[model samples]
Target: MPQPHQADGPAQHAAGRQLPAPRTPSPRDAPPLNWGVIAPGGIAGSFVDALHTHTEQRVVAVGSRDPERARAFADRFGIPAAYGSYAEVLDDQRVDIVYIASPHSAHFAHALQAIEAGRHVLVEKAFTRNAREAERLIEAAGERGVFLMEAMWTRFLPHIDVVRQVLDSGLLGEVRTVAADHGQFMNPDAAHRLFAPELAGGALLDLGVYPVSFASMVLGPFASLTAVGEKAFTGVDGQASIVVTNESGAHGVLNTTLFARTPTTASISGTHARLEIEGDFYAPATVRLISREREVLDSYVPAQREGGLCYEAAEAARCVAAGRLESDLMPLDETLRVMRALDEIRRDLGVAYPGE
Candidate 1:
């Protein structure tokens, strides 16, 4: 087992045992992967900034309906080429994979298009409008022998890796209860993206997913779920609270909102200790692990790098070069499982999309 000294290390198995070390590939073992960008949006900007961290990755081109928009994005990020439409990038033989950042409603379509065009995909999260849409992309990717992964960027962050490590070490004892929340105040205008039905806008698909994903990360799939959500006049959920229970009786509480301020906090409690994550729990930040003795152990403090978002881009580059279709840490099954949980939560809350 690694001492407290290796705080960023992978979680060791319980009983003071060491888990297997990560096997690194030699130069002879990996292949080249040239990446493309589809839908130049705000979230894509983060990917653009983060992708610069990897020498192994290249953002060859960008595609959008508005040619000028695509060119401007390319220029801002130093990408080499821009296309007038997504179809062009999908058809580009030089591009090995595509990172998608369209609206939630378009994730299914965009991912399917990329898969059909024989390109691997890293899709932005909340993978789609619902589990059904997510499963569609997954099935198509499987059939096409192409890679498809949800861009659950938080799960790939350095801090989250460290969090997983701490939990597995048994130093926290058996995790008994969990809590996470993400909230923000969004304007109520129907034209705003948060309230626009056309964009598939709402709190649950937006800020809500992070806390829910965090809970699932710690607790795994819940055996049962219950939720309550407050809806906007536009009929979209403005806030939601969900409770999930594991077979072991562990309780997970998650909250998300576009209607209130929620501190954006998180914690995990166990027989021996508890961990309190600071503001912006999903990103680069600090967490305090408290013990029965009231001692505090902090990890992931004063991040060596800001905007830890780039780590996911680096991880994808490594995985693709190593011929991996999906990340070992963030597997396709896990993505589907999260979507399924979200789907059930929406159902229980009486939230339904236009088509549904």
Candidate 2:
């Protein structure tokens, strides 16, 4: 472990320095692409809405298992095509990319379908059921030479860009700890996806991913971790608390649960200063930089809020236009590392999905 820096007057005065500004470009500046939506659920609606509101990208087609659902979604969003099966979305010639907003268990299959159809893919977060599934999708996308990314929207937000700049500038000195938690009180009905084993549902995959990925961004890959969890009535993980250590010995303390509402805040503590984020840290929230003596140095608040998801869409559009196969901001390798960490956490918690 690296030794902590001794507090010096100059170092203490460092907090008075100006913080870096976000360099994220405007969503409207990216090249437009026609997008297809598979599994037109609530998240897909939000994504399409964001794109339509903030970017030039078009949602040309939508697909759902229920024909009515598909048509309804398409009509609601002014989409041109609606199909009864997800395969139709993948097969649509007009779609340059397909967004997979299916449930956890369906991500691998839906993304693979899009890849096989030669469409770029953006799978929503908790990218897949496990690391193995994540690896398979990445390898498939690579073999096909198509763009693939996990819709970790937080990574693309302007505030997050500011966080990235701060970390890279070494303004915080050596980071020693990261702490984040996300919890939501959910209806525990067995049929709801959150409590369903068949759908690979759990608090860890749905709610925990934010904190885990945030820690990964701040502390690099996890080297080792200790996890303990409780099960809901439906035999799925209800809550989990984890302490992860990175290769540099920095620690991440994380927690997630479906039984209660948490502050949903996050923080990074380093030798010289600390960065703190407001509740719903994974979304467009305020970020604060503070000295070790607890003086606020600076803070950041977004100028826009309603369509924050457009940032990720803009990134996807930019990468596709540049012919890049994956985003440097949310690389496939990091997705896999985070998945492996989640897998280990689930393993230690004795949580397993029905169909693997």
Candidate 3:
């Protein structure tokens, strides 16, 4: 297993005993690759900035429907190429991989385009509008023998690796529950993408994916789930609560909302110990391991990155260099499973995207 990156500051502990430090690699340690970014959206900007600031990976090109926007993004990021269209980016023979930063509705088409063009892809999350689309992309990538992975960057963070190590060590002892929430207040204007049906807008697909993916990470796929939600005036889900039970009887409680900001924290509790991830848990944050008796066993504070999105980019570069088709840390199967769960949640909430 890849060790976690060392913590930023000196290790802090209880009772004057230092806890173990994470051993994940620094971004500078990842193999470099030439990248082409699609959409050049907010998230893409963050990704490019993190790569430039921390990793050896280079954003060679940027593409957008608007040529001027493409050029601006490229100029801002110091990219060498700016294409007027996504097709041109895919056609760039020098581009080793394409990062699809398009909206959820366009993920399938964009990813399929990259696969057919013989380019590896790292599609931003939600993976797709639904599971069917996710499956199609996975199958296409498999047939093309090119790499494809969802940019679930959280899974690749150093603190996440530490969580994995703790879980694998059986320190948690029969994990019983996973709880997480992600919510952000958004403008309720019907024209906004977050509430626009044509864009596949909804709290479930946007803010909800984090908690859902977190639950999936802690407790595999759910065997059954029950959900309840309130819809926004614009006909999208404004808030939702979900309870999922896996085959092993482990339960996950998840909630997401666009109506208000939430604590955005997460916890995994087992018979013997529990791990608590601090607020904004999906980002670069802290984790605490505590015993059933409520004593702090250890605490992990991760080194901060500009945006922490480079971790997934680095993983993608490593996998492509190794001729691998997918990442073990965030596999295609897991992406598909999470999509299925999202689909179920939408069904229970009676929220359907256009043409779904």
Candidate 4:
């Protein structure tokens, strides 16, 4: 077994093999930006609430195809303006950035519109329907000179920062494998978004992206992957089990399903140690470092419980304030790479969305 290194470097461990403290800054420290939200959906509501409860940022406007829905969301959140169309939100002079919270199928078009309007954009994840859309958005953002980011909220969480520090510090020796799974039981109704191919509905885009992104974060880039999948009643992918190999020959075992609830846990194993994240690992949760002997060396618990969405918002706000086109933590290149990997998986599984 490989032994953990004792180094005087960026991360300083505690006495007796303790974990490093997370270097994440408070969300409130980020410079404030006026945000306009598109699509008053469930995720949007949570995002707006997190921003209001934790950051100095303000949501100046909200827009939806349905006027009453936009008005209701605005009133609920105390936002100043409610528009009946996404174009109205894009046209608002006060919006420094646009947050596109639309469904997976709509991410590309909505984010493209925001970029064309010269508004910095934060797109909800599974950034686009495929790698092609992701590339176009990145190119458009470059031409427009506006910031663009996929809101992969887990990447910005405090617990994840601790995991990053541990990996960087070599506490886990030669990292060999990463394993993660995310699954949720969804209704079988054909009309539900998860079952509709037109909406890009599937286990992979909606539920699998978490484990795939987590694996990408730990393993860098995918060199090759093999996938086995099953389809839902509506012809959308219902589950997938994928094994990926990175350039360094490290392996990532990932799984996702819409047919059952899973542990949703994740673990990274190395020659000397392993780090395990609690269930619902994509959100704020406990992280524990274990030794080769299976002894717990250290553990970390997050300070906040419910409003974890604010961290990603704060990251976007900071990036825009610093005149950046994308975040260092979740770069556009990585986003495209992940999309390519997802595309490969979909192809292997024979899962195709309607109209590309």
Candidate 5:
């Protein structure tokens, strides 16, 4: 497997590079990465779609509580094995990694199970129902000498590398503020998993993690956070506003909601200028750099034909090949920080889940 080349700042675009020379991965390599997915759902399907776009990684097994549903997802993706129980997938000796695609409430148990079974795990965000759960899983993974990662897919996108380069290159100037919001209309039936307390239904955990993670990625962990939000009929936070002040006094305004559609956009302002991310910013989209008199920035488009989720998969494969347990860009520490922020916001709004 050929590792991806390092992507430098926004200046790479000034040279007329059309597509990023990203790492092209193939499971055909000597030490292939075999992936198993648990609780296939909307996002899991997207990850499977993205996995197809890359090489060196394959969804070897699909697992669900319902055998028929597991088989359906496996058939949909041409996966080799379908298991009726998550434990069976974990028991499969060939599975090198297990993706915890279950609802937020189940993340802790599922990820810990995979790690204990000697398989690396990728838990979807919000990594767990709360920071306490995240800590427990992180500690468990560390104790087992296995790998664990939160599937906060945005940080692995080419845009993250691009933006980091732009900021480090001194092209963005001193940081001023970061504003991000990700929300969508959710009219799920009262019984839908997203609208049920047992499933940890809420906008803060599902849609809100993106903006909060984006802000933290740019500004690092905040030193102070003051937030307020509104709950839905089910008492889950459907709307929330978080004001974060970093140690440097740099401020960030992050918002999330499930009741209605927001722009699903994000922006970063600096002492000298600002960067405008394209709508659907979470999916490795584009961003424009704007200054007083000139627009001196290049926005990134999706680099592959399939879903962009493969970027993180590619990173995981690379790290495993290198014998590393964690990723630099999307570290477990960062995952815990963002989850803690969401936890605080949920607490402020008095939105409690089943485990809490």
Candidate 6:
């Protein structure tokens, strides 16, 4: 049996082993940015809270289709300006970057608008309704020479870096399988955005993206994929199970659902060992590395925070300050690849939104 090693810090293994400590810079370490929010939705609110509480970033303005809503959100977040339309926010020369929190179906248009206006953009996940849209936005951002990134916040968290270190060390010995799931018991009403086709209402876009992205982080882009799902009354997929295989013969099993709440856990198994991420893996959480014989080798638990969104915000700000057009950690190519995988999953499920 392979013996574990101990280390000098909390990252020590049982057998005198030591993994490189995660090098996550503090949010305050990043250069400050003058941010504008494109949509005053729940996510935007959470993002604003995280930035205000943990970083030097400033949310100078917020915009919404509803003027009253914009003002209300601004008040809640202590933002200085509120706009009745997104164009107004973009027009604010004071804003250096825009966080596009609009619905998935609207991401392409909003991101393109920001790029055209010569502003950097950090768009929410499910970057767009489909990969084609993602490709177009990526091309536009590249041509405009502006920074663009998908706000898959989990990718920047400290724990994920630790996972990366573990994988890079070859301690796991050829990861062969990755399994993850995300589910929430959302209201089934057809009018609810979670079930409306016109809104891109589906578990895959909102919830599955977490697992799909998680798998991609571990397994890379899928070489082939197969998916099965159940549709809701509103003609959207309520739940789905997907199996993706990469060129190395590694496999990823992923699931997501709007019909019920699940454990939201994830695990990666390799030839010699495995790593188990605790429930809510995509968020700030814990991880355990175990040997093939089920011996616990090491464990990691990140310091808890009010919210972890600040990490991604800081990364974006740092990249922008460094004059990088895209984050290496969450590149446009990777985002496009993940979107393509999602498109395939949706196609297999026979689910299509309005306007394809």
Reference-based lDDT, residue 178, model 6: 94
Q: Report the lDDT tens digits of candidate 1 across residue range 1-356.
A: 11332454454323223222212232122344678999999988877776665334678989999999999999999998899999999888889989999988788898999999999999998898888888788899888988778888888766676678767666666788899999998878988877876687889888988988898889887888889988887878888899998877888999999988889989988876777888889876677767667766444463444656566666676777676788876788888888888888878777777753
- Across residues 1-356, which tens digit of lDDT does each residue of candidate 2 receive? 32333444685445335567799999999999999999998899999999999999999999999999999999999999999999888788999999999999999999999999999999999999999999999999999999999999999999999889878767788889999999999987988999999999989989999999999999887888899999999989999999999898999999999999999999998887889999989999899998889998899988887888899999999999999999999999999999999999999999999989
Most accurate candidate by TM-score: 4
Query: Each model's TM-score, in the order given?
Result: 0.89, 0.96, 0.94, 0.97, 0.90, 0.95
Better of 1 and 4 by TM-score: 4
**Full-model lDDT for every candidate:** 0.79, 0.92, 0.88, 0.93, 0.80, 0.90
Question: Which residue pairs show backbone clashes in model 4?
Answer: none
For residues 256-292, could you state the per-residue lDDT of candidate 6 as single tens digits? 9999999999999988688899989999888888888
Select the stronger candidate by TM-score from 1 and 3. 3
* Superior candidate under lDDT, 3 versus 4: 4
Clashing pairs in 2: none
lDDT of 2 at 34: 96
Candidate 3, superposed: residue stretches over 4 Å from native: 1-20
State the TM-score for model 4: 0.97
What is the alpha-carbon lDDT for the whole of candidate 1?
0.79
- For candidate 4, write residues 1-356 as lDDT tens digits: 23456564544445326877889999999999999999999999999999999999999999999999999999999999999999999999999999999999999999999999999999999999999999999999999999999999999999999999878767788789999999999989998998999999999988899999999999888888999999999888999999998887889999999999999999999987899999999999999999889899989989897999999999999999999999998999999988998999899889899898
Encode model 3's per-residue lDDT on 1-356: one tens digit a residue. Answer: 11222223343113222234665677788789999999999999999999998899989999999999999999998999999999999989889999999988898999999999999999998899999999999999999999999999999999898888776656676888999999999977987888988788889888899999999988887889999999999888899999999888999999999999999999999876789999899998899988778888788888784569989999999899999999999999999999999999999999888875
For model 1, the stretches where C-alpha displacement exceeds 4 angstroms are: 1-32, 53-56
| Cα lDDT of model 5 by residue, 1-356, tens digit | 11112445576434322323323343234255899999989999999888775555888999999999999999999999999999999999889989999989889889989988989988888899989999999899899988888888787776667676666655555777899998889885687666777789878888888999998988888898887898877777778899998877888999888878999888888765677787788876777777745565455655543467777787777777787898886899998998898888877888888656
90, model 5: CA deviation in Å? 0.8
Each candidate's number of clashing pairs is: 0, 0, 6, 0, 5, 7
In model 3, residue pairs whose N, Cα or C atoms come closer than 3 Å (at least 3 residues apart or on different chains), thus clashing, are 3-23, 3-24, 4-23, 4-24, 5-23, 5-24
Q: Which residue pairs show collisions in model 1?
A: none
Please give me the total number of clashing residue pairs in predicted model 3.
6
Pitting candidate 1 against candidate 6, the one with the higher TM-score is: 6
